[model samples]
Target: MSETTNVMNSEVVKRLLCYVSYDTQSKDESSEVPSTQKQFDLAKVLKKELEEIGASDVRLSDHCYVYAKIPSNLDKKVPAIGFIAHMDTSPALSGKDIKPQIIQNYDGGVIKLGESGFSMGPNEFPALAELKGKSLITTDGTTLLGADDKAGVAEIMTMAAFFLAHPEVKHGDICIAFTPDEEVGNGVEYFDVPGFGADFAYTVDGGSVGEIEYENFNAANLRVEVQGYGIHPGSAKGKMKNAIRMAMEFEQMLTVFDNPEYTDGYEGFHHLGGIEGDSDHTTMHYIVRDHDAGKLNQKLAEIDKASEYLNFKYGEGSFKVVRTGSYQNMKEMILPHMHLVEYAKEAMRELGLNAKSVPIRGGTDGARLSFMGLPCPNLCTGGANYHGRFEYACIEQMELCVEILKKIVEKYAVKEI
Candidate 1:
């Protein structure tokens, strides 16, 4: 790459630093689409920037979605594509006043985060060792870096601006969206898929630098309730049916060893994320996950059976489990049109990166959109440790991300049979 034509331009990096400053963490407990108004604060700014960059139909919707259409120049027929990234950060940690640590030419050892004991240690995260020679952007140990999707946003914005300035590139209509509440699972809830028309889309929200996911967990949120009859322990012996005890027992019936801490890599797990209980009433919250739909359904059934077994032992209606739909694997939506994945992979390879396809242990807006008649697969933003305090991203890898999006546009803009 020549000096003038090289990727990883300084303007993109500066824009990334500017984006990470916004605190847009979404609340899962909140019922609203954006979950927080702070997301809009960022969305408004992005819409203005998009307009300045010459994007057409740049609109920020009431639901806190920013959409822009980049027009095509070539006379040849090409499939319209969408590039998506989320604006909200994970609610797991604070995304406020993010202090990013920029490491230039990392040397493959323990790089302590700020003045704290937390570090990019090879002993702890061996993946850091793989990034020995790369430039890394990490948090300052006090707060999360919000790189989970912000890097994705920066990458998409950079590519969009690049294409707008260089109309000679001759790309097709490129649909770009920056969504809110992605961390809270409401990214595509109010999204107008038909409004922002595209043949397919790719979400820049996956981990690592080369991930391309079309499969994800068939998720279901579970709520278990236990009811017990209260009685005076001193006056009545064996009359006290403790609901808390029943609730604890209910949790015990499930395989505790199958927890997140004990699971990884395509292995399914039944995790109890939260629990609240007392002698008279008890409630437990869990999320069942599996890449295989059959296995996921089996886990949900097992949870119901566990509750039913307790109910049978204590009495009818003593304890019950309620299941609610969360998100489905996008593979069902993408399998029919697998070429989009191929396009993304070809783009990555053209930019000299690996084409690694993996199952998403979690969900994304793409997962929902894919089910909603859009074959969307997830792309990488060079981020890691998502939704956690230890979140970080490789700046050099983010540079690659921008280049990959450009190539995807280039590939589709001109195709020969």
Candidate 2:
């Protein structure tokens, strides 16, 4: 019933729809900063839109990062807060020519997607049960909805528009940015944290409403290579060692219960992402994740132990393990600034939203930015089932998120904490 809620509803939806229409899916294999050139499409649009909305210092970096500022209206200086979101969608699904389906007044039943034969109900997606009577936006089953962070982008843009429209609202310097390739984990690769000019910031790239995240998994990528002797099948008793089978053995050495499908809520996981090879040579790709840094190291040690045992059993140099650190949990960085979390919770509470601090099962740009310098936390964008065809967003929840953001800005404006 609040003025902000009413005003942001349509505008946020319009922005989201416009953003998803651009094919901004980032590629993981590319060496480019954005990983894909299409991300600039959305970046350009955001830059133009930000300038049009009266935001100052609007600049779209060559690397596809859009940065802008809303000058402080108050005479007294307060902490400059930044709001961030990503411009790229995940490469898991095709993001080209997306035709969004807008379901008005969702009735808590099985809603079918457009002609792609995909239907989701309360039974499958339990989150849908609580979303009845709300307006839902979904994909047509042919492509992803791009709501993972586009919803966040739209919410931030809408909030910026609100602040620019109401000068009397009185706020400190508001920093705004939309970075590229967040889906591929290079969102902050070219980000200039010092130049961003924020005492602290938030990445509005979370699921559902009222979810505030500061903790995320300590992540690493693992590659295991196996070399085996190949012989004719006619005489392959003890003379031949199959690399594919050895690779499977290396996988079995990992704890079965520690896999992604079996783990949840702070539990570490070793996910076997893919396997490629033949009898002579095999390669296994895995991602290791845990909330605790020590536990994450333990997981990597376990992989090393498995590799050593396999090498001992087979032959030296038969098993190889390569571990690469991805990103660490942001809890330590944000702990020194717990007020950021409290302010977000307080803002949501004032808007009748029950904010909950949840651990991010995956990483965000904020996770890296936190360690870089800014104590940034993650905020909800009213999205669900990210990076896939079943992705959707709740219109009412998104409007509430915009309001929550507005409230957070207002709090920072009046108080320094």
By lDDT, who's the top model here?
A: 2
lDDT of 2 by residue, 1-417 (tens): 112344345999989989999999999757889898888888889999998999999998889999999999998989999999998989899999999988887889998888988888889899999999888889889999999889999999999999999999989999999999888879999998888899999999999899999999999987888999988889999799999999988899888999899989999999999899999999999999999999999999999999999999999999988874489999999999998999999999888888899999999999999999999999999999998989999999999999999998999988866
lDDT of 1 at 225: 79
In candidate 1, how many Å is residue 355 off? 1.3
Q: Residue 110 in model 1: shift from native, Å?
A: 1.2
TM agreement with the true structure for every prediction: 0.95, 0.96
Instruction: Please give the range of 10 consecutive residues that has the lowest summed lDDT in model 1.
Output: 1-10
- Superposed on all Cα atoms, the candidates' RMSDs to the truth, in angstroms, are 3.1, 2.8
Best by TM-score: 2
Model 2's alpha-carbon lDDT is 0.91
Please list the residue runs of candidate 2 whose C-alpha ends up more than 4 Å from where it truly belongs after superposition.
1-9, 231-238
